[model samples]
Target chain A: MKEIYLDNNATTKVDEAVFEEMRPYFCELYGNPSSMHFFGGQVQGKVSEARNRVAALLGASPEEIIFTACGTESDNAAIRSALEVFPERRHVITSRVEHPAVLTQCRNLTQKGYRVTEIGVDGAGRLDMEEYRKAIDDDTAIVSFMWANNETGVIFPVEEAAAIAKTKGALFHSDAVQAIGKIPINMDGSAIDMLSLSGHKLHAPKGIGVLYLRRGTPFRPFLVGGHQERSRRAGTENAAAIIALGKACELAGQHMEAENTIVKAQRDRLQDALMVAIPNARINGGGAERLPNTTSIAFEFVEGEAILLLLSELGICASSGSACTSGSLEPSHVLRAMGVPFTCAHGSIRFSLSRFTTDTEIDTVIREMPAIIARLRQMSPFGREFLKGQA
Target chain B: MWDYTPIVKDHFLNPRNVGDIPDADAVGEVGSLACGDALKLYLKLDDNKDKILDAKFQTFGCASAIASSSALTEMVKGKTMDEALAISNQDIADFLGGLPEEKMHCSVMGQEALEVAIFKYRGMDIPEHDSEHDHGHAYPDHEGTIVCKCFGITDTFLKKVIETNRLTTAEQVTHFTKAGGACGGCIPKIQELIAQVLGDADVQPRTRPEKLSNMKKMQLIQEVLERDVRPLLWADGGDLELIDIDGSRVQVAFRKACAGCASSGNTARMVEVKLRDLVAEDIVVEEVSA
Candidate 1:
């Protein structure tokens, strides 16, 4: 069966070009960058070039980039460092819909007696700016929020939220794992003190991530070992993945416009067709500014797992906010935090596109989706009653 | 991803009986739209009303829920109502190889719908001991005090599921009934209910004799201590040695982590209770340095 994978927000296929660029370093150039020999020193230059390429995409200095294991590590390091630096500050703040990488860490901080405030989201999944501004105080250690939600594709105003944190002297961090490749970021004069982006989210291989730390932020090391990444982050450099990530970042910069145009068109086409063909359905984060490559549609009276499994039978892969899909027994925290109605919360399906997503893939999804919803709705008691009443 | 069994996949892809019986004899419904999954079952019975002629279901749930419902309909076709009610949740799960532990509630839901359909159709008042959520529905669902308000599951419903499945831990109860699967305000209550169920089973092994001579009582107390109490302490890197027994007063010395521990007083109480439950109601356990 020809697979039509629409779950890019979860992870993406490694780009062929990016994979080829890092091929030579596996055995031929596999020397440790920390070694004194010329073989190792030569590999160091390529690593620095990778750093510069990643820095160029974000409009920041190469030295500001800290290579970690993955996006979760960067998030953990940034928030933990802020708390350690401002140990006297008894407060921290984050949004309710952040990826578990940031949200879990902030929640654990509360156990250590830190007052963690999770600001709420509106019906459209936009952050409550009033709640955020009021939550931050001079005693706050950090404010960690995401640049975009992985589930709903709803973009947050992190820069503006960071500006509010600045007045209170709290370090601001953004988990840009979902937003990095799709959005054009200029971190040069931004109030964001720290930012996190993962490699697998882009075309680079998994297990590689970048933490953009402002040059002069009070910091501590999450990993304390060899003097790697300026001793800010330790462990033997992941040479091949770092090189691949650099190449992927450059490619992301070049294709940024296409991401906003071609990918957005495909996303819009898929969403429009599904909405038109399927009745009693509405888009999540519809009224908010969202990433161009993503759309979460909630079809009422049908559960998401059934739709996803049926989609999987056709080799069309998608994701869901239903409790059965996730290991938990409730809908996704993102949909719940947005106050989505109970009727639709368990039926939301998210389809995210990428630069590699073609129009045919989009068409295949749009063509197969309505009947899938109709079939599951036919099996649903609520769907049969409401649909009958409508007829 | 859930490692769904091939049978579960087959049933979900092409569900066995996927429609409603228009003039069905029994209509049983459970779960609401607010909850993630809901099932409305329609049953067609033979003229005598003793056997199920055909069964169909309309389920709003995941693959497991659909597969479970599909399996239930197939299992009940041509069976007597009593035989259908004998079908436990584990039997439904066993029909599909097995479900993921987290998806066990899907099987429980299937069994509940079957019971509700038959019991309501028979016009019999359902037996229930918990009376918290007794709104007296179209069918007599004496659900009894609602324990998990998020799922609208009652303690009576949960206790039946818990006992039928032989579930031991609070986590197992959540997977089997979704009692503590949300907000988790009732986890402590679920734990209490589990203990209550487990406590009922705990008293079955040894019955306290109605009449016993003093010599027989002393021997039974020592036997209960050696058989039941010592192994439990030994598992926790602690042990207790029986020092002496005189009539109702039995003495023991704590060893290892139990020795000189602040909570040893509580440990002595535990030993006393074990002896009292098995040996004699008036039995008292005393700690002595040996």
Candidate 2:
């Protein structure tokens, strides 16, 4: 069976060009960029070049882009530093649909006696901008909003929300992990004081990320040991992964348009075919403007684990909300916030196409899915009743 | 990926007798939406009422849940109705190799479904044992919280099994009480019970070299049978004799049930697994062929 990968939202295959660019850094140019020696100075030179490459992609100055471990670390640093910058300002504003990286940090702060305002999202997983505006006040130290949702692919209006936070004299941090490569982003024009991006999500190796800290922003370092990352984040830099991420950003610039056009078309085609094949299936976060390459559908009656297992057997890779939260039995917090019904919640499957995804692969999934759904439904009491009602 | 046992992997990769039977003699269904697992079983009975002609199922749950149902269908099909009902949930799990701790509930569901299906066919009322309803079995001297809610095998149960069976340690009581096996959250309680039981024993200090063998499993089963089931049978003026064993199954002879009660089907069926697991693995025990 031809292996088909449709779970790009979870992670993408590393681009060959990016990997090749990173190879020399791993063995040959392996030196501490912090040291004053010639070998270390040469290492520092390559690090600066990687920083410039990432900065150019985000339309920011090289000095504004600080390398971190991953998007989660960047998010944590941004949120934690923002609060630390203004200790007396005890309030933080964020949407409930934000990734756990942001939501969890905010929750930890709340436990430490900081007031947190978790703004609710609309039924489509879009943030309630009015609620966000109401939540941000003079005492609110920071407003952390995600540029796009990881699970639902719903894009939030971060620019407008950042402007509101700016007016309130609060710092704005946008977790741009999902949006950095797939969509065009420029920190120069946006009011977002800080933004985070992960490498693995953009066809680069994992364990490397970029934090775009707007120039002239007041900041506090999260990791305060080494002088690396200009004392903003203290750790030995993952030079190879950082170089790979730089190459990935350069590739992203060249492929963003084609990815939006071709991958979006294929995603739409798959959604259309699936809708015709399976009854009572609806796209999650369908009402909002979403990332072009992602689609999450909830299949009524069948749980996600069974669906993924069957798909794995057929050499088709996809993801599900239920399996991600298997032992806990909680539905995806994003989907739950969107008011997705429980009947479909357990069965939600996410199919995310990438720049590498092909039309034939999408068609194969469209063809194989109806039969798989039918097979599972035949064995399910809920599914049997659903099919009977459809008849 | 988890290192699933070969049986679990086989059942997961290719579950047996899936899909609904067009017509079935009886059906058993359990599990709920809130629990995130459910199963529906279909049984086709032979006209002679001696064997299950066919069995199929529809299971909606996790990998282990589906695999358990598949394993059960594989074990019961073509077997006599009495033989099918005698199959335990543990046998279903063991056949699937083994399931994870949390996933033991899947095997439990399969076993419960089989018993309910038999009850449905026999026109007997299926006992709806409410897990929430507390039994009046008071904790005589134990203070720890109860675990292994399935068998209600508490610390007290462990103490009793140990004291009554000449069980010198926790390991022997675990075989009978079934504590610290499923879930294993009750292991500390089992250890405490062992300490309490051993401290009270009046036996002299004699170093008895334990007989260690490769087939410790077989030895444990034999000991359980000798100490537990043998006395109960003797009291009823009946006896059980071991015949032979191929693998986990053991053939046994029931002196009274072989020719007595019309409901001998219940004895030949219900107690067969308990007898088999208790007997030696090579000693297949069955009621003498009528």
Best-performing candidate as measured by DockQ: 1
**Segments of candidate 1 deviating more than 4 angstroms:** B125-143, B206-290
Model 2 C-alpha lDDT per residue in residues A309-391, reported as the tens digit of each score:
78888999998887322444346778778888766777889999899898889988998998887877776766776778878
Per-residue CA lDDT of model 1 for A155-191, tens digit only, reads 9999999999999999999999999989899999999
Clashing pairs in 1: B132-B145, B133-B144, B133-B145
lDDT string, candidate 2, B63-118, tens digits: 77788899999899999888987776556766875555345556767876777787
RMSD versus native structure for model 2: 11.2
The residue-level lDDT of candidate 2 at A339 comes to: 82
Query: Candidate 2: deviation at residue B58, Å?
Result: 1.2
Residue A312 lDDT (model 1): 91
